[model samples]
Target: MNWIILILAGLFEVAFAFCLGKAKETTGNEMYFWYAGFLAALSISMGLLIKATQTLPIGTAYAVWTGIGAVGTVLVGIWVFKEPAGFLRLLFLTTLIGSIIGLKAVSSH
Candidate 1:
């Protein structure tokens, strides 16, 4: 269950990051709403990650969270915003995933 929660928290981290990217282009009243939402999601996700770290090693959990969030966000940015989707970008993303899994496995002991 903790792992599940941690994964969800990481997903939320990605979501908030996406929201921030969008909000960066805006500067009116609507921007504040997006900023507020981003802040709330970021804070809650970080708190959840901290709670999850009670059972998981900090390095392993943080790596997983950051890796997933960054990869997911970049993927979304490409699909949703038509950002660059080059082979090198995907290769690096794959490497991030591999390293995250390796770190988690090694730290699980």
Candidate 2:
């Protein structure tokens, strides 16, 4: 259950991070909404992640949470924001995902 919450929190972290980038691209009222919501969500998610880390090992929890958030955010940035989507991007993401899985396996025992 706690791990589930941590993963969900990480997803929210990615969402807020994307919103922050989008907020920077916009102007006026929409900017305020995006920025505020992004910051609020980001903070809350971090808190939840920290709470989760109390039970889970810091290295494993942080690695998995951040890896998923970063990978998802980059994908979103590529598809939605038209950011670069090249082989290098895939390579790095793949490595990070593998590392996360390895760390999780080691931590489980």
Q: Provide backbone clash counts, one per model.
A: 0, 0
Error of 1 at 51 (Å): 1.1
User: What is the C-alpha lDDT profile of model 2 across 1-109, one tens digit per residue?
Assistant: 7788788878988889889888989999999999999988888889889888888888788888888799889888998899998998889988988987787778863
Give the Cα lDDT of each candidate: 0.85, 0.86
10 residues in a row with least lDDT, candidate 1: 100-109
- For 71-101, candidate 1 gives per-residue lDDT tens digits of 8898889987789989998899889989977
**What's the distance in Å from true for residue 70, model 1?**
1.0
Maximum-lDDT candidate = 2
Runs with alpha carbons beyond 4 Å of true place in candidate 2: none
